[model samples]
Target: MNRNTFVPVNEPLLKGNEEKYLLECIRTGWISSEGPFIKQFEEQLAARVGRKYGVAVSNGSVALDASVAALGIGAGDEVILPAFTIISCAAAIVRSGAVPVVVDCDPVTWNMDVAQVEARITPRTKAIMVVHIFGLPVDMKPMLALAHRYGLKVIEDAAEMHGQTYAGKPCGSFGDISTFSFYPNKHITTGEGGMIMTDDPALAEKCRSLRNLCFKPEQRFVHDELGWNFRMTNMQAALGVAQLEQLDKFVQIKRRMGARYTSLLAGIPGIQLPLPRTDFADNIYWVYGLVLADSVPFDAKEAMTRLAKLGIGTRPYFWPMHEQPVFRKMGLFAGESYPVAERIARRGFYVPSGLALTDGQMEQVAEAMRKVFQ
Candidate 1:
């Protein structure tokens, strides 16, 4: 591989449409958060997710925070979430002035362990934030049942699962509030943008107000409650609208690349490939992940470093949030053991799987992995 030609772990799938939409926004002088693109993008996303409303925001983290706030989750509340996820999940809870109860992930799906979730629910438990990590949907049937039993709100972090489905229902449609990220590396890109989807009209209004510093209609200059300036710009929304138009096509490419990776890596010893769910038909893979079995000579970090040396960029699975220094110091987590999350963090790594990657590049990645493991 030439040093000049770098195969990134993931890349944005942008075309001329994105540039054209942005230029239109600039020409219309609607470059700020308030513009036609914002409403159009929100409506289009809501329709895609089978939801009634969608509120665009600055980014996914703020979307999560706004969702929590919209649902009246605040001090002394506990939000259950998988420990094996991006740090933003826990951070969002903390930022909302609530305690995050970190649960272990299911070994099979690497999503929040439903069994652990039941055991973790307390009187203070206000909600459950399910992160569909790497585009694999959590078994929502059982999770939703549990939430209903306990009267806890459900927030779906569909950041990595733009077009995925669970039990025939869309990934973002199940929860009380669902959040998505539009970072460059996600299934879609808007430079930096996010959205909150909900069927409840009241919650939708609250989200809109919260994202704009909780402005009041009665008093023009008066603030009803404390909120942040977490608003998405029209420029970003314009890009998002354009990207949303190509989402299905991009998802198709991702599915094809993921299948190719599995076909090439499945039979390799010491490699445990990601398993597709039988019940779910649509899985928009954000990354092609694999785990090193216990018998493997090296851990995830070692394998990633070796692959990197071969010009194949790879990434380790997320570190369990309960063990992170900040969360541990806060004394938020109760249980001492989260074996599944810890083990996955140590053994798992992901190869490049992006719409931007060619089949030939995937072959190169697979060949590099074979060389490392052989």
Candidate 2:
């Protein structure tokens, strides 16, 4: 165990104008949700994402909820999602009053298996929420074809995949609507914020109006419909503007780090490194994930314990949504088994792959891993 070095799973990289943006926000006195920074951030992000409109919100979950709500999805409708992602994806669907249909993930990409998604669609299926897990872009061609055939909308949960591309198109631009999280651990940080991107002007307007309490343009106090206050502060938008300016550079660093880890751990036994997909031109490796082989002497928990003792932090993949207690009580996914998601959850462990991590630090973590698996 290295007492001097404690490698965390992820850390935010705040450099190159973050402080300046904060200072600018403070000086301008537009720290609230309404200001020039928010507008600027939305426009810049829209352009960067190749979308016609971008709606800034309080957080990723809220952005997702807004997008779903904007689509008019509610009770009697179903949204298909993979069981191997953050709970927020399911939460957003539930909040929008839609039934969440949990599907299996592709073992290779750890993303929604397009084949499984097609199998789960029903007459009530209104949308599909595809998460770009671990910054790897999901194969959208088949998913898009399925959606088109079924007349289902697609909402991309691109929280972890900033600056990632599928073929030549950006990940966030593939679906009908895409949501991003600017949380500290994500590729970019705005302290706590989110953005929704869409090419549909009507959907974009609905998102913007829903975020601002569904206020009508003709009246100040009159509300057209029920809505939540999911607005982002100008301060956060300022940070986001600065963060966006350096997103490409940050993604490049992440790619290099991922490649280095892959090279260093290539021949190591009992470890399955994430494979890059040619369909996706770039992968902004948010966390360098490794799946423990079933033949390994230890389970993912045991490996995590050993790594923690070695001062190396690790995180397990998301537990299958069907197995969660909340969803269990809801009885939405009874007797359903997503074998791939369950296996990944039990065997996957991702170590520190933050932007702040140095090559030597990664080497040290890899050494510790080698010691554990040996």
Give the C-alpha lDDT of model 1: 0.87
Residue-level lDDT for 177 in candidate 2? 96
Question: On residues 1-374, what C-alpha lDDT tens digit does candidate 2 reach at each position?
Answer: 55568888877888779899889889988889978899999999999889999999999989988999999999889999989998888988887778999888888888888788888889999999988889678889989999999999999988988888888777799789999998888888888899999999999999999999988899977996998899999999989998899988998899999899988887889898987555656567888899998899778999999999888988888888888899889877888898999999999979898888899889989899888988
Please give the range of 10 consecutive residues that has the lowest summed lDDT in model 2.
275-284
Report the lDDT tens digits of candidate 1 across residue range 82-199: 9899998889889879988888888877888778899889999999999998868888888999999999999999998887888778889987999999988888888888999999
223, model 2: CA deviation in Å?
Answer: 1.9
Mark the regions of model 1 whose C-alpha exceeds 4 Å error after superposition: 1-4
Best by TM-score: 2
Measured against the true structure, the TM-scores of the candidates, in listed sequence, are 0.96, 0.97
The C-alpha stretches of model 2 lying farther than 4 A from their native spots are 1-4
Write down the TM-score for model 1.
0.96
Global lDDT of model 2:
0.88
